[model samples]
Target: MEENGLLNDWTNEHPLFDNGQGDKLSRKSIAAIVKKYAVKARCVNPAIIPEGISPHSMRHSKAMMLQDTGINLVYIRDFLGHSSVTTTEIYARIGTRQKLEAIEKTALSPEPGSLPIWQRNRGLLEMLENPRDVVFNYYL
Candidate 1:
């Protein structure tokens, strides 16, 4: 929280990840450090870990995790410090399994309490006669 100025908190204005010598760790160095940790984790859990994980993939996973919780892409963009929303929108793209799961949630049935008008009114028969006008959507 303090490193990011989040929750209106502060832990000395010093850089959070600093080299032992005294200066802040550069972005390249941070990536290397993250990879080192990933390698350590991979050794402990070989079955769960992939061979070539990096900090960038970790960032992508974080963005996707936030999207999974239904956070808006605009907010995600800001949270990731992205200059454009398009950059953040990539995380919102759903996988095929996610799409299938979402589709499975819909209950397929006729509109509740709304009987087909054409069934009772002969005048409305044109709706059923015209294929273009006949909408078979059951999940509203």
Candidate 2:
């Protein structure tokens, strides 16, 4: 191999991820490579590669990882070759864990004394305790 025009001892004719002809691997070739590695990985641990894992799933995983890292959705859209940001917005939907994390991060802790007197009123507590006793006057 050559590094900055300086010859090195590394002597592989093809790149580690290239096709045998020193060209970029085709989509099918890439899928085949992923499948081969997945099979090998399954031998080590079946949970590593679940059934029906495909190249598309890897792409989706990468998109999710990018979203989790706070990368802009527009950038992720471009990276994933989406026609519009709307298409990329699917990945922006927060999971349950992310929703909880966001809530925890922004949760407010107010002093008990800061609440209005109405909030602590016994009438309000009684109303909550006996919802069936309350009558609705929607016309009013």
| Per-model tally of clashing residue pairs | 0, 0
Encode model 2's per-residue lDDT on 22-112: one tens digit a residue.
6868889888888999999999999989777789888887887888777899999999999999999885655434544554465465477
TM-scores for every predicted model: 0.59, 0.56
**Candidate 2's TM-score:** 0.56
Residue 4 lDDT in model 1? 54
Clash list (residue pairs), candidate 2: none
lDDT of candidates 1 onward, in order: 0.65, 0.68
